[model samples]
Target: MERENAPVGPGDVVALVDGSFFMHRTYHLAASGDPARNLRPSDGFPNGAIRKFCERLLGFLEAGFGGTRPSHLGIFFDHSRRSHRSELFPGYKANRPEPPADLEALKPLFRDAVRAFGYGCIEAENYEADDLIATYATAASARGAHVLMVGSDKDLLQLVGPTVFAFDFEYGVPGRSGYRPARLFDAAAVAAAWEGTPPERLGDVLALMGDQTDNVPGVPGIGMKTAAKLVAEYGDLETLLANADAIKQPGRRDALLAHAETARLSRRLVELERNAPMPVPLDDLLLGWPDPDVLFPFVNAMEFSWLGRKLGQLYQVEASSYPSDPRFAAPVAGSGAAGLQALRYDAVLPAEGAPPFASDTAHCAVSAMPLSMAHIDGWLRFDFRSPDLRAEPGQGHEGWKIHVSVDPGRVAAAWDAILPIVAEARLQAKVAGPALAGRLGDSSHRQAGKMLVLYAETAPDVGRWRAVLTRVEEALDKAGVTPGPRVAGDR
Candidate 1:
């Protein structure tokens, strides 16, 4: 496939997607309904992941970054599941079970779908999608083109710098009608997410606090906050380990001394390989107008009427012209925000005793303060004019959270009492932290009282949290729950 237009030059946005990450996530969490029901009409092939992947990519391309469409795009998949990380540490990602057989069978179709859109479908042997994304991002950055790394993987955050950013596309939770809003993270967002440990030093934090998902042996007992704190204090992992003997905390000192080599290995495992050999030069990835000749046929075969409408909008034509497979039933709604009936908004806030959020303009600019993530406290979640759209057991959603510690003493009363308050406040004021906790897990109730600590995402809008709190307080006056003293510096 050839691009019909000129390739992107300097200052164009190059969007690189982590294909394997998206495919598996879509197959498991984003694609609605059963895989059996979403098979391609031409053949009995499962095309749920393929359809959702294309839908999201199209949505992203339409949405663009800061009102600019991506000049180039690459969907890079893992050449194989195993990567150099596994070779460096045998136990790497051993904790993960095998990808579903049905999902694995659909990889080739995903690649074909990418090609149909006239975008680069790339993969290199023994390299993970992260490495490829890192490499392309680095190359794109060096060329003076901005890089947008798509996917929810934290490992990719290390690539966020002056001209590079990461975007986590929002998707509907499994078994839910509402969708999570997409989030864009820049250097400040990365620092906010990683407890003020700069994006470049996130590897040090990850090294100290091993990733259970990847089975990296970060020093045991070291969590994200502790690791971030240590890295912030010591500058890096090596410095922290070298000065372990002078550490005041006995347990931490002992863990660093005991797992010095293990921590080093974890760092290596978590670090991205930015120098992978690309099968095609960066110019080859530049996107042109989507060929209706190729795209229409694929969507037609799959009976993607909703996708057809989106494509029609993209091509500036009547959506009715596109044909769908008569046998397959079309989705009840169209694609993107307008098609979805409900929106689930969730965000992190700055908790009490934390410094104000700071925005970073070098990467991307947003108004917000950095809330402290010093500890995990019990969370308070409520609905916003929608049915409970929680995920099924063991399913994963975006990890973005709005941290507020509900009073344990008032847990019973506050649980049901805050529903209407949250819903109304969110609707009237348009605060961005109104969503159900998709899956509940273990949380601490240590400061379970009138105190409400709002922990924001790395860099979050301070006014959003403040507005929500003001509305919640006004509503609370008429309800059972009592508002605690507001945090200092809170408007």
Candidate 2:
């Protein structure tokens, strides 16, 4: 059944995992050293170390898969001591210590354990796991299979392309309420965040700085920042070396001139071998189900009770033993502020009034029209009117009478209490109706007399009214309009 679904397709993905490096790192962190050292224990076994290590790997894989499973999975391990890179740089990764005795003892066990889980494992003599992964990734890409390389190593950034992504599995923090898959750092993302240099040139950049962790000797004295800057300017190590004299700083120039050979070699060391042999075909890389019964025993033997329980829970959930709801209530009230407020309105002015421009109006026609209104149901509304007393355009168009209505019945004393609030919240007199008054003296006013209409809404919550008033004031300020004095109640 698993074989039927194993073939590579358009959406099929292959996971090129660095099993050897990951296991060594995890084991080192979990178990410091063998309790009994080199001498075998009385039980005639090499301690139960490999079992524990396998348990951790199993747990990580299970969690990595989660509810959705990957189409293909392949674990690449480092099998050889002399990789092709060694020929280019004699001192490539030469300074690292050998794997610890206990971990070394369990290396074979780890390989067997990966196989037990029905995953295709690959290792080439003298080639690092990275080379094997690069080889598989290149092959998978050529075969039209998407590849997700799962590792945090910065060197893997080179493999990221349209079809290939790098996943940093170690950075997964527990209890975070999101499914943050290992993000593939592409060329653009790397350039933007990592000193603005392209991912392909990252190797050349690293070669100049030298990775101390990987034992690659970069140019002495130059650090990451300088290397990035030099690469950004000169493009790569070859050009930078050729134009050594062009470097402005004497210190950097001297460093580059002095360690040109080392920088070149370091570049070779950091470069991934894309043509290495892949043992498994891209189609065979599809993930297959491991015997859960066998897997649980392995977890139990390793004393990983937590992992065992988690596996059981995973299986149960997959079997639909757990009930889940699609319409679960969200944290928001109704999507967000949906049920918070309802709109309402009231009238403070008479339905029929003077045409607002009585033909024979006098100069003192500025009426302080006091209109009082309320939102009985905790709703508030504001109506403002600015009348031109002077028959002229620009001269007397600045003054305005604002009529604000408050729901006196809804909130006791709301009328008296809201008056000061509204007064404080009124628009600036000069700015209130500036646009309309600007045309006051212009001949356009005879055709369309300037009038200021201010509208406001009130709620039981003073904060809501205050917010609305602030918004209105801001709008008036932006629009370059000034308001007139406010009046209450309808006249």
Candidate 3:
């Protein structure tokens, strides 16, 4: 990965993010009280998905495959609710409920956020993230670049091959204590996951096995295993359907014969379109250094203090010293070394140490380093020990964690109220008291006994901590989650 502001060359790595898959997935997790989904700005915009996506983008850039970084990256999204598949079959994805309003509201910001970080945001009016990714991957791979598709959609594996791979990006691995590298799938790996159906023939397999999620109508009685076996024996969907009578299994043969045309339609639905119009030139996506002038205010406004600090270190500027309001400031033309020097000075805190955040009750100034940030952990112990529960300390009073319990059943309902504090204050949390059982989507109805533990870092004392807790209380109050009696160690 040669990322020195040069053109994307042969042998360079290209990473394409399936932005739509991640946003919807994050929304579902956040709606269930997942700590990572709580990012809300002062303006109350839904930014959790965007924030997490950006974090993963940073992680991907930092942790390239096998010590090789991606020299080019693109964030691809679906254009709208409908696509060519929907046009081909009105019943495509018809089973899904209407998308949540918050999720829809966050769509416009996806492009803005991606551009702010200097990555390409690609889309086509009637194509999905998968299709656009396929198009880009094809083009980039043709240019001799290895393509890394960052997404979990099985449909993407169709593009996995010698020059292409697919994987999902997650901030925290479920039930894991530390970072877990995602399993990258090449042609062989895709085949293994699909029961010996190779990547190229996956469409043929899917053609026989209808996808209920997408409402693609294949041969009614065929399943993944049977479909894979049939495709392997016949070598393709067309051949398999043409010779349905030869399948000794009467039920399978009859079903295939009855649904031959439907199977072809299903194959079309599952096929990736490799020629969707490019929204931007491939050369434009070549990795470039992020401009601090635009990057600093954007993260600060989103109240992503920890990320701001991390990026500040990379760019050598105090991101917090920039305005708290978000703005994509255009770079000053030819603002050479002298101009950057002045901006860096402006980003520097006063010689007296650190400046107090102007928010009401935001009085403490703490070091953003990991060692000092660990002081907040001494506040208490939790019932569970998952990586998502850990607090990410920030530089000011707002960068802290406060642990509190809410009835586990109320966690989901109270998320709306609780989100702002989590984002604005950059807090972290956990679930304690009792284990939640059953599906979390029905969490509001479940009579769980566990308590939700919300935590943060950077609170220097009990007073500052209480000030933050007061806001949480007000939010929780709105959601009808009254504070229980204080725990023994509570200050």
Candidate 3's C-alpha lDDT?
0.64
lDDT of 1 at 184: 90
lDDT for each candidate structure: 0.63, 0.55, 0.64
lDDT of 1 by residue, 263-314 (tens): 9999999999999979767888777767777777767766666787778877
Off by over 4 Å in 2: 1-5, 32-68, 170-184, 292-491
Best by TM-score: 3
Candidate 3's residue-wise lDDT over 248-346, tens digit each? 988998888888899999999999999998967887787776666666677777777678889988878888788743222221111233522321211
**Over all chains combined, what TM-score does candidate 3 have?**
0.63
- Please identify which of the two predictions, 2 or 3, would achieve the higher lDDT against the true structure: 3
Clashing pairs in 3: 399-457, 400-456, 400-457, 401-455, 401-456, 401-457, 402-455, 402-456, 434-450
Candidate 1 wrongly placed segments (more than 4 Å): 4-9, 30-37, 41-45, 65-67, 173-180, 309-491
Task: Please provide TM-scores, in order, for all candidate models, with all chains considered together.
Answer: 0.61, 0.55, 0.63
Q: Ranking by lDDT, best first?
A: 3, 1, 2
